[model samples]
Each structure stands twice: as structure tokens, then as C-alpha cells.
Target: MPVNMAEDGNVAPGLSAPIGGKKIFFVRHGKTEWNNQLRYQGATDIPLNAEGRLQARRAALRFSLAKVDAVISSPLSRAYETAEEIASFHKGAAVEKTSLLTEVDFGEWEGRTVAEIRENYAEIFEAWRVNQLNVDAPGGEKADDLYERCGELSKLLLARPERSIVVVGHGAMLRALFPRLLALPRVSYFWRTRIDNCSITAFGADAGRFVLLFQNDTTHLKVAEGRIASLPLL
Candidate 1:
């Protein structure tokens, strides 16, 4: 059963029992140059850097042993490339793009560094940091807008015939959506919730509700890093 939207646009547990066991792996895309520079890349189509590629490869290796049924991604190149890496391990799996999965629109702040935003738009930035749900990015989107899209995405994933699905997307959007899916307070959404590049968060359907299995699991990357470090030098 798919989660339904409440009158307040929050996620509500479905009334009907789920037909079959279903799981969702929410994967954030690997790092990009913008990510390394701490730039606001909302809606900016930045490609992955060398380190990002390695991160994606490590993430791929992690999922290679899992029963991944489908790969869904944001249209952004960084996310799509990461999804491609995951799809490589799952033969016959196709990567599907969804606009709903795209990163939050940064508006005038896109491509700007946090420092720059703080220097130029301190009031707006501070307001957003304090209460993101109520504040809109200067000419960009508010938290509620992102929640609506994520709500749509939740429904789409629930409707899928596949039992196990991998959704690759951006950090901001994922962070924004996480609270809604868990029915947590919107104010508590981003605080202390780490959604690292190529990190995997998992959820499982139980009794017509989505239960969070884990959040920001990147142990596989640590193993991969150890393996790389252990390689003999030529």
C-alpha cells in the first residue's frame, strides 16, 4: 500500500496492507565539483569529479550483492551518472529520471558559495536556516514546495511493481523529504541528519507504512577506501 497525503500534505499511512514486501534504497548522488567547493548547486547540472566517480563505484559495489529491481534518478547529470553506476551492477535494470527527484531550486543563490550568500543575503539565509519550511530561497523554493514533490515521489515509488527500488537524488531534496516520510516534525528535518554523497538510506514497508531501516550508511565506502589504501604501490 502506498502512503497517502494528509490534509496538511504530510504522509499518512495507507489504509490497505501492502501487497508484497517492498524496500526502497534512497541514495544521494556522488560528490561534484560544486559539492567540493561548498557551492549552492540547486538545479545546477554539475558533473561528478574524479573522487565522485570513485565514490559512485564504491556505492555500486555495495549494491552489487543486493537484489536491486529498479534504478530511479534525478535528471541532473551527477545523479544520473551515479544511478548509471548502480545500474551497471544490476543487469537489465534501466535508469529512469524524475523531475520530482531534482535538487531544490536555489534561485539567485545557485552556484554561489555559502559565504557569499551569507555576506549578501544574510537575512534570508538566516531565516532559512532557522525555519526552512516557512522561508523561501530568494526566488527559489520553500520547504513545503519540496515536500509536495517528495510526497509525489513517495506515491510513485509505492506504485511501482518492483519490490526493491533504488532512488538516486540530491542531498537537499532528500533531507527535506526524510522528515515527511517518517512523519517527523518539519523543523527537525535537516538537523543532525547527515545525507552524505553516495550514502545509502533504506526504508521497508511494514503493515502499510514505511519504516526507516537505516539512515546515511556509508560503511561500504570506508571498506572501499581501505581496499584502495591497501593496494601495493607500483
Candidate 2:
């Protein structure tokens, strides 16, 4: 089972003093070319584009003053690049990559646009759009699979000794992880949540449970670029 998170208010930089618990900040990797093209990039190791690099820089600046003990990222280039940007600020913070943080495998649905998927696999696509839990991406993992991964990740995170950890990951995986951490209904929340690229979501660990500090925060992007309208809504 995944660790549950308690809902809370306005988030500050890192945890408040890092008293005795752990704080984990989740950052969605910057946009990729496929992201701009509205294509599914599940498990694809796409690199960040020019705009994405800039976004990553901005995200890094967002935590410049915070105390980051460690930075964990998906092995995918997009996420690793973003993690690099953030890790640059915290001089000694080690940036570690793990396959467990990789994006959900879209299988046959990978590298295709929603329209293309709908046109080709109409019934399955529509059913998935209506209720994601009812169907799986052709040959890909199901919600349970992703949820189990999230649970394993939670256990790993909780066991870590680091006080503040930054996790850079992909859209589908992060979306799946959030609901699982919050102990919410996965199917409903998964589709509804909008985890924009480079957005910052944070949580604090206490008493074997996590607390939601804030979620889907894009203040860094707005302040740095003032181009929130152009950002990808992954």
C-alpha cells in the first residue's frame, strides 16, 4: 500500500525548517517535442527542447534557496535534464536516476496523438477517455500496475534518510503517484489532475504518512517567463 498524504495549505520553499520529518517535492519534467505535438510519450526517452530547457532553468531557480538533500529523477532524458537543472543549485545534492520513476508504458499508443489513437482504436480509446480504469493502453500496463509501482516508490522514499528530496518524473507516472499518495480514488483523479511541465508539487512525511503541502504549483514559470499560456498541460 502507498503512504497516505494529509491535505494542507500554501507551500513554502522546502519544508519549514526540516524539523524532524522528510519533505519530497515532485517536479514534472519540462516539455518535449512530442509534448508540443500532443503525442503520447510514454516510456520514450525524449530530450527536452529549447523551451523545455528554459523551463527547467526556471524551475531550478525556484528552489535555489531551499535546502535540497537529494534529487531523484527518472532515467529518461527529459526528466534527468530537468533534475540536472535543479541539482545545479544545491551544490552537493546528488542527482540519482531510477527506472522506477520512468513514465508509464503506452505500448502501441506511444508516439501517437490522441486523435490518431481515437481514429484507430475508437472503442477502446473512447472507453478509456470515459473511464481510464476500464481499459489499458494496448499492450501497456494497467492502473494496478502503475499503482503498484507507486507503492513501491513510496516505500523506498519513506525509508530514505534524506530530509528534503526532489523527484523529477513524467506526467502519467506522477499523476498516478499523486492520487496513490493522497489516498484518493485513482481513476477519477488521474484524468482530472493537470500536472503541467515543470510544475512543483510538494509533500511532507510524518508519522509514516505524507502531507500535501501544495500541488501543481506553476508560480516559478509565471514569474520567470510570464508565458504560462504557452506551457504544455501534460
Candidate 3:
């Protein structure tokens, strides 16, 4: 809420010392071999594909027009590649990689699509969807783990003292973080907030307060360049 000074007649919240005014330029890594297979490529080091590279380029163009103070990303091949693409344009902006933003560790389900997982882990598969409980991914991180880590990343971004920052992260991790940021219910899955590859998400922040701006935007994607004919909508 904006407060107006009676005499000045100007709306001003009396700006406090700004935090990492860092705008997180969240991004989804490009396509991987597993992506083509429709598999869950979490915690796995999968590189981007040709189309994914192009998508990264398009995403960079979007950032080129924004105020990017720093670039931080997940320590995965795909995420790093996408960050590198953006750095190509902002030559001086360094890309920092951290494991905190990694996708959910899919454990036994890694590299396999849902169809395949259902064959053996049938009950677990069914349970996994509604398994929003504090459950584990068989051999992976629990629902709470991803949220905790991403939350840490969020706070770090807010404290950076920089005006804005960009974070390149995975979809599942992004899924986990969004709800927490919006004060939504904490669950493994929350209404399936899907984002496209090489997309950008923004959160408005000041002194650690967050307001969602736009999400899962892929207007930068070109029909001729992306693997998917059209960006998926959620």
C-alpha cells in the first residue's frame, strides 16, 4: 500500500534500505535426451539439446532488456548451460552455480517417464501424485527438502544488497518455491504449476517482501526453435 504525504501529495512508502533488490530471473533449462523421452530429469546431470540452446538464446534476449545484477543457477548441466547463454550477452555478469536450486532428486525414478514408473512402482506412483505428505522419492529428497533449499535461495537473493539477481532453476524446484513465496500450502505438488523450457519468471521484491509479477512466460520462444510445437499452459 502506498502512503501519501499530506503536504508533498506524493505516494511513498518511505523506502527503507533495499535488500538484494535482486530480481530473480528464474529459467528452466533447455531440452535434454530425457526431456524428449518425457522423463523426470531431476538431480541428474543432463545437457541441453539444440532446441534448448536456442531457447536459452531467446531467454537471454529477454534478460538483455532487464536490469540483471547477478546470475545464479543450479549446479546442473542444463541449468548452467542456460545461464551461460545469458552471460554471453552480459559479458561482465558472472554465473554462480549452487546445488540449492537443483530439481527434486527423482531417485529410482530418474531418467524414466511416468508411464514407465507406474509399471513397477504402481502404488508408489499413485501415491506420489497425492503423496504431497512429507514423503520421500524412494531414494530421493523428501517434499520438505526441496522447499527448504529453494527457500534459502530466495532469502539469499533478497539479502544480496544488489538491486536484482537472476536465478536459473529447474521446474520441480520452481514449483516448490512458488507456493512458499505466495504463502500457499506446502506440498510436493501444488496444482501442477508447469513452466516451459527456457522460460522466465519474475518476483517483485523489496526489503525481503515478495510479490509475484509474472510466471512461466515463454513469449521469447520461437515456434521454429522450441522442441515443443507450442509452449505448454498451466
Q: Give me the displacement of residue 93 in model 3, in angstroms.
A: 0.8
- Can you tell me which runs of candidate 2 are displaced by over 4 Å? 1-20, 225-234
* Residue 60 displacement in candidate 2 (angstroms): 0.4
5-66: candidate 1 lDDT, tens digit per residue: 33222254454333246888899999999999999999989999999999998888777777
lDDT of each: 0.82, 0.82, 0.73
Q: What tens-digit string does per-residue lDDT give for candidate 3 at 1-234?
A: 554444231245554323233455578887777888899888889999888887787777766655567888899989999998887667668998887888889899998887888887888777777744366678888776766786787677667776667788887778777767756666655446777787778775754467566787877675444433234321
lDDT of 3: 0.73
**Over 4 Å off in model 1, which ranges?**
1-20, 225-234
Superposition TM-score, candidate 2 onto the true structure: 0.85
- What clash count goes with each model? 1, 0, 7
Model 2 agreement with the true structure over 109-219: per-residue lDDT tens digits: 999998899899899877776666446889887867877888899888878899889999988888778766766665645678789999998887766777677788887
Prediction 3 TM-score vs. true: 0.82
